[model samples]
Target: MYLFILLPVILYILIRKKSFKKVLRLHKVSPQQIFITMLLILAIQPMTALAARIMEHLLGHGFFPPMGDMSANGSGNLFMSLFIIAVTPAICEEVFMRGVVLDGYRHIPLWKTAIMNGVLFGLFHNNFMQLSYTSIVGIILTYVVVFTNSIYPAILMHFVMNALSVLMEKYPTSLYANFTIWYETNMVLLILLAIVSICATILLLIWLKRLSNNSAIESMDASDNSIEASDALNHTITFVEWPLMLATAISVIYSLMMVYAM
Candidate 1:
């Protein structure tokens, strides 16, 4: 996961952002939109998780094993693990998968490219049970990156979704056991979380719609500014320095291994 995910990301952000200002300008994302997206990540994650679970069962899998193993260590190690899983992936994966790979295919029909990118992302995961569920999540994220044209938005969304699952996993099994009890134990906490998750879903939907409109306006303005440049501008990454790519690959792999090695 580390080698596959991060090496290309560091290369893209450092190389692409510098070389391709037009790519950066393709999506107009305001500060307000970014904040709302961060909030929505906290809100919509549980719903997304539930959705993934349902898909697993529908696909004949009982439950999907998580990509991030929460209890791997750190009885109190939440902070460190959060860095590896949430912060690192938010940046690297977004840059590599969405920014580089998805945008690389911009010439294809936009929607098709987005969905295909999402499916590819899902398959990129090592976990077998998560393939179907993560694919759905990947599709949503792909649309997000395409519409906004910024990895920041995608990274923010990904962070929120991941942090929550880590928190849940780090919780004492004793505490969660109560919630897991079918008849009556920890239902209250789970119920409250469910409510919070639903609220997050609604807010996320609103935020996405708002972003959609703003993006449309920005695209129109851009098109008016240039009939030819819009078409002339390309999204592919070429001639990336090999050194940056190699360093990034080593850093990400070492970081993840050090964190998860426990």
Candidate 2:
């Protein structure tokens, strides 16, 4: 599935003769941006968990249970699980989402691009329960990519989220596990923590965006404002197409069946 998601994006870049570096935004970002991206990713987790819980409650429990524990005893199995669950999706999914899909929507306004990309990303998962929280994660991931103007931050975000789950499961007595136990038991505290973390995430994102905007302005000032460049930035196009519509319909129908069947 990871390769299936990524291969077409690579081929499209090659066929279009676009620079891989530019398409993937492989340029470096500042330490400050990297730090904030890490914090933003961590801060949003509780809220995302809450969203997923709410979705499960609505869809019924065990709708999408974990296939098996990633916390196997052997180091070999652990590494393999991490590679399959975390690393592969982090690279492949980020390339498709933030790399190609985002570049395709560059003509749209920033917020529009982020929201649409996020929604499409959630649907791409084809799981109703995941769609609830992954959409939220996707929006934040898009913002991280956009603000940093580098795909690496988004890749890190994806890896950290998945890897943490694997590691925390491996070490059940970890601080994160203790916190999860308490948080799940206390409804009020869970709500309060989620709200606080969400606010922090927004503040951090705004700061990152401010820094990104400053950098963008400086770059524009340094560049020759060629007609071609201006046209590319100003270009607009209809976002609705048959492929996306078809995919959305299929995912919706499949998710509905799964939700009700179980």
Candidate 3:
């Protein structure tokens, strides 16, 4: 249901733009920077598990996210987690949350819109444990959406993050098994992720500023009527067509099924 509902909508967005392109590359993230960005996220995972284990060990309480039924060896869980965590959410969420709503709210300041909507995205997860983690991630994702002014980077990052989780779970103990475990327990990766995110953000900001100076990121024309920025809502499919409403209905039903299944 989730897939059925979201596939068309994002496809519509992709089709909206005559062409699409990449924004940022984290892998090309120099070795020195990788260490900085990935260190904290990698380190904290084990501690989170260990802490939770210790708490349960002492108090007979193993607390987990109500919304997250993740485990090391759950059957068929890998693909499920991959799609749920990565692809579907990436497209649908980016479109609705960052693309549509945030864009609509451009009436507010951009930074303010990014922050406020990102917090809303986090809360949309509807879980206490996930609230903090997803909020952090939501903010990061929102910034990337804002940074690139495109959703592809967010989708790529989201897909990689989720697919990596599946890969690590399958091959749990290896020479670099630490990385896998780090993601399974998100906190481990978060420390390094935070540092890297911060640095990347600073770099990205500088890049955006440079682009602005050159009018590369958001180009302007000679005429005030022609603000050549994509941010300008020059075109929109606001006909209230049947497909749009049908898609919305399908999305609601799909959401209901997912919640029902959970």
Candidate 4:
């Protein structure tokens, strides 16, 4: 938690010349936009799970053991768990990944920016198991931040996702036993569920794109000509300089070592 805050602050001071407010996108979002983001996240959960499972099967290995196990440790304090697992990560990770790192790539195309942000966020975990799904979630969160022009939605979504993970861990058998059994017994149902979730996610993305377009139009009307002209051109993907490539390579190597060591 501390590193997340400190590292970003240090980087901002040393490298990023942009204002913290602009870099962090600490703007307000409408209640409706928050609701839509939440819905989109919920709709994509099943698909993400399926993707993770497929990745696990292809790799022939299970996920690395979690650093901490709340249930196993008998950490029955709900408030503490929520604070540590959900709130801290939502605030700290967003400040670093979506705030500082993302701002550094503002000159690039939005899609490229989002993908790079997601990849960096995934590698930041330093675990192969989390890299796949977390990257996907990161991409979605990046899109949300870009479209809404606010970090609050990304923070909220991250919190909700982490909270759900905590809850599922706490009540794994009780909460999902029936669904797990049904899924195992009925392949068709599992496939259908994945398909439906993916379709819903796609539709929500389309809706979000429309909302982003409207927001961009409003921003253009309110802003100066320089901003409008900057938005008009798509930037090339030359943002991956040597330093970034070296850091990413190191992260991947570290993650592989950790995975094998486990």
Best by lDDT: 2
The segments of candidate 1 whose C-alpha lies over 4 angstroms from its true place after superposition are: 1-4, 9-28, 39-47, 58-70, 73-76, 172-262
Give the whole-model CA lDDT for all candidates, comma-separated.
0.57, 0.73, 0.49, 0.70
The residue pairs that clash in candidate 1, if any, are 43-200, 178-186
* Model 4: CA > 4 A from native: 4-7, 10-17, 64-75, 173-187, 213-238, 242-262
For model 2 the local lDDT of residue 191 reads 81
Better of 3 and 4 by lDDT: 4
lDDT tens readout by residue for model 3, 1-262: 2465355545654766522232111113333333323443343344344444444446554344422455322445767666665566666665555554444443334454456655666556554444444555556666555544555555555566555555655566864567644553565454555455556655654453343332222321222344346744542232223333543555466667768877
Ranking by lDDT: 2, 4, 1, 3
Ranking by TM-score: 2, 4, 1, 3
User: Using alpha carbons, what is the TM-score of model 1?
Assistant: 0.60
Q: Clashes in model 2: which pairs?
A: none
lDDT of 2: 0.73
The estimated TM-scores of all candidates read 0.60, 0.80, 0.54, 0.76
Name the candidate, 2 or 3, with the larger TM-score value. Answer: 2
Per residue, candidate 1 scores C-alpha lDDT tens digits across 45-136 of 45555555555657776563543454344344788878866777777666666665654454444455556666666655545566655666
**Winner of 1 and 3 under lDDT:** 1
Which of 1 and 4 is ahead in TM-score? Answer: 4
Candidate 2, residues 162-201, lDDT tens digits: the string is 8877766667799987887678557677788889889999
Can you write out model 4's per-residue Cα lDDT over 1-262, one digit (the tens) per residue? 5553536455754684667778788888776787789898778776776767777777888753562564333377766787878888798778777776776666555666778889888878766787888888888888888788888989999999887766766676764645654663455666688799889977886677666643543443343334345544433223566325544654565557656855
RMSD to native for every prediction? 7.7, 5.9, 8.7, 5.4
Model 1 local distance difference test score: 0.57
Whole-model alpha-carbon lDDT for candidate 3: 0.49
